[model samples]
Target: MIAAFLGMRLYSVLGRKAEHEEEIIQGRFKQEEEARDVPPPTATGADSARVEPVIAGFPPAIERGLREISTADRNFELIGFMEGAKGAYEVVLEAFWQGDKEELRELCDDDVYQSFAAAIDEREAMGVTLDNKLIRIEDSTVHSAQLDGKIARIAVIFVSDIASVTRDKDGNVIAGSLDDAVESRDIWTFSRDIRSDNPQWLLDETDIG
Candidate 1:
């Protein structure tokens, strides 16, 4: 099941080459310097009733939820959050494949971290290692967004192509092929406390889309 879910398809010449390069994991939620410096909008007595502009094209429910989240957290920006989510997806996948538990712990919530750690432990017991490559990300969009009190959760649907291979202790390919890439659709939810000073969001849930 894992093998079947972890194959990739090349989207372009550049993507094909990128699949072979070492994964560069950077700050998962780092925003640009200029973006960070910009202060959140403040409403005085007259402008207190002003409603934030909602981005169109999303479903009514999603739009409502996003608006609620934005209201709760003045620093929330849809475009920047989506970009950061995409980067987080790549970083988390590569860290899991490399069995980097420390990195995974920092990127994911406790429950999610435990799930990934358990999978790594199982693979180690079997004397097998995953060789997975994210060939291309075809799409990454917000599927849902909601705010519960000061906690905001956003689920993103990621449509990506991955190449995966399982190697035995002797370095022989035991399952999957790197040449064949398959599309995978995953819904991953990230959550953050709007009241917190830290701007980082942690992966809390994952599902097949």
Candidate 2:
């Protein structure tokens, strides 16, 4: 009779403890499910806005240069050469957008290439960050041309803005500067001769201010 009484008490105590543990586990599971159902915070301000489209186009004179795009004759190839030069200009725009030096080198002439590369190197050395937000081919005009002689000159205008942030050696931003989104128009001259086997014309010169 004594043994039966002690066994019954022990069994009652264990059953209650098991029920308490089960309640704690169920409570924890409920809290976790509630957290999972909660929605994430929404983004605000400009961060939520859509990005603007990139715009690029050439002037009327480019069509005139395209006249020589024919491969049948050397004279016609001269026109192709001018068109090729224009294409190089477009390539430079792409490089600026992508922040790539190699791409610029392929399209830029020796002197111009050195100037641009040096600027990039200096900025990198000083921890300066550069951002080119916009590049637009605004206008272009034909300066002079001699299609029969396989030589042409054209002026292309482009507008672009650059933003720079200067940083210290420790990579801390010190000075930030932005060129007031000014209208920058560049005039690029192109020339080539018929007798020259070189189908691609050189960038004779450029006036950028």
Candidate 3:
């Protein structure tokens, strides 16, 4: 996971899928389940049966984009990016819950920052506090990826279990059960300016599935 505050520059700052559709917004918030039955690349290179760079699980277009990303950013690694996404997910949730605009600023784009800030403000104004916890990240996968001009973006799906509870100023249980962990699916897009010195991929957009 990223730090409580995103102060690290480059990769640490901006670095980091779903089911149901025809259009795959590689960098936008869209959903579609591709050929997931295909397996990932295996470690057993001696066996000629293993495809070195497996493309079985990804849709063709997305697979092509992944190749482009690798060509564009030598530092890009599918596994590393997946792990980074997990951390970023946790950081964003914690920051949003705490209404930490400073932390959000470094991690998300201006529009997203404004949206989260507004939501946090509204929740606070209502004299309500949310206690949210990420119980576990069950799965993570890429839904789409693309490069527009010098910008590169990838949308990912995070399957997770979360425990949450909301309380009024009087501390009365309001929404969500404190004891139950709810399953959730989130699609988020992260983008980075490939031509720039900045390595951070900002949180460009999000959608719930």
Candidate 4:
């Protein structure tokens, strides 16, 4: 019986079916298994595999054009155009307050500037001040940019909250509080036409009404 049991354990160990139970059975007859089980070799390209970098195509001309257009389009931003608008608004607002048509000649559109200036003059003749306050930018977006010939017409959507105030020449606020802001929106199109003599950037026109 002992020999038969020892023979069975040896057969199981040689067949690679020597579990802890087989070891116990063989050890009972003072026999040791030839080899112990070990984990399988790790498969290559399984975990932590390095990936190859993808090659991207390059179009130099198209890339350059896109960059140039992006740079020109930046002029329609709030802060960028705000500087010019602030200056223009200051002149227009003061002229409107004083009713000075001559001061708005080169600063604004002819008809609109003249009409606004006339109104200011009429009010000033009556001892009135038109307090125009530029409050906050409600919305701003680039409407369109069309490249025509060698020029680009960039249209921008400008919207803001403005408080038009009225003061008595003494600098005393008579009407319209700073809190009295109203929504005002407009589409301003600026044209940049390439020139031959200058060969530089120039503002050809600004839509005003």
Candidate 5:
């Protein structure tokens, strides 16, 4: 009788401990489930009123043209396109000035390619070579834009400085600078068919200033 009583008392103590541990586990699970139900913090007050749009600092004509292009091409971005134009400016001039017709053909139109070829030929016949290096592009702005049917034409004005000098076949400085950088302004026009899949814009015309 005594042994049976002791065994029952031990079992009672173990049952209470087990129930206590089960209660702790259930409480933890409930806390975790409750935490998941809470919503993320809301951005209230002035934060809710802030809305950003494309900022324009161009002339009314340019702004209107940009809007037109934006309507036609949803992916067109002003700041990014301007930045790319600046890079293309450097690439095209670097190739043309160095008499790389193949590279020029990839960047410019047929007439532009022919003109560049003629200039290069003239320079070659004169037995004078040009050593030119772009120092920096000071500024670049879109002068105008027009959408004619499916084609989009944009004229950009680029102001740049370069270190350049002309030397004869025997290496004589004929013109320009070898050390000092000179500024050059060019109004370059580019055209592309917006409906086409090709994203490359061709250099159509240029006016030097």
Candidate 6:
């Protein structure tokens, strides 16, 4: 009877200890799982306050104009605008060469579209086609930027190498050679109405850089 009583006392103590250890291990595993599930911390207001606005590399006058434009249009981003301007330059040149009036109409304002259309008409009358290829854009920069009331305008200067050939109706190369690339510098202005919901900017003006 004494032996049986000792055995029961030992079993009770050991069982309670084992159950407590199991509960502790289970709790630890749960804590580890929760830690793994936690998301990374986002930037807080104080952290964001430490960040500065990016400055566009330009002259003082141009920077002031850009600032005004930025104030007028909250969504205006200089880098994005520069990229878009470069793309537009290529697209407009290609469209003009191919005499794609519909595409030019969408990209240019009324006056600019009229100018491109007139050039296309003249080219068609001469029975000459432009076989032009934009080799590469060497440089592109914002020459000027301004906010005129609700309309924001930005002019970009693009320097590019282009291989151009004038082909006659008989497919004869007449003027330029494809082997020779010419450096073309052009200033193109893009304008947008900040109050409008449309995010697109139209080519409003063009000039030799």
Highest lDDT model number: 1
Q: Give the higher-TM-score candidate: 3 or 5.
A: 3
lDDT of each: 0.68, 0.39, 0.62, 0.40, 0.59, 0.64
What lDDT does candidate 6 reach at residue 99?
Answer: 89
Give per-model TM-scores: 0.77, 0.45, 0.73, 0.42, 0.71, 0.74
The top-ranked prediction according to TM-score is 1
Cα lDDT tens digits, model 4, 116-174, are 54455556565655567777666665555555554544444557787766666687866
Off by over 4 Å in 4: 1-103, 109-112, 147-152, 168-174, 196-209
Residue-level lDDT of model 2, residues 1-209, one tens digit each, is: 32243224323321221111011110010111132242111111121112111001333444444333222232343223333444556555445434577755544445444445555564455444444434444544444333445444344434444343334557564544455454545555543343545433444445653
Candidate 6 per-residue lDDT over residues 1-209, each given as its tens digit: 32243224323321221111011110010111132242111111222112215435578878888788666666666665666677677777887889898867766766666667776776677677878899999999888878888778788888999987777788887767789998878787777777866566777777777
Candidate 4 pairs with clashing backbones: 99-120, 99-121, 131-165
Global local distance difference test of model 6: 0.64
Candidate order, TM-score descending = 1, 6, 3, 5, 2, 4
How close is each model in CA RMSD to the real structure? 9.7, 31.9, 12.1, 41.2, 34.1, 32.9
Q: What local lDDT score does residue 131 receive in model 1, on the 0 to 100 scale?
A: 90
Q: Model 6, 11: alpha-carbon shift in Å?
A: 99
Judging by lDDT, tell me the better candidate of 1 and 4: 1
**lDDT by residue (tens digit), candidate 1, 1-209:** 53442322111111211112112233234433243232211111212133344345689999889888877777677766776788778878887888899878767776666667777787777677889899999999889989978778888999999987888889898787899998988888887777877677777777777
What's the candidate order when arranged by decreasing lDDT? 1, 6, 3, 5, 4, 2
- Tell me the spans in candidate 3 whose CA falls farther than 4 Å from its real position: 1-57
What's the lDDT for residue 198 in model 1?
69
C-alpha lDDT (0 to 100) for residue 123 of candidate 5: 68
lDDT at residue 86 of model 6 (Cα atoms): 75
Q: What would the per-residue lDDT of candidate 5 be over residues 123-200, giving only the tens digit for each residue?
A: 677676667789999998889887777667777888999887677789887666768997878777766666755444
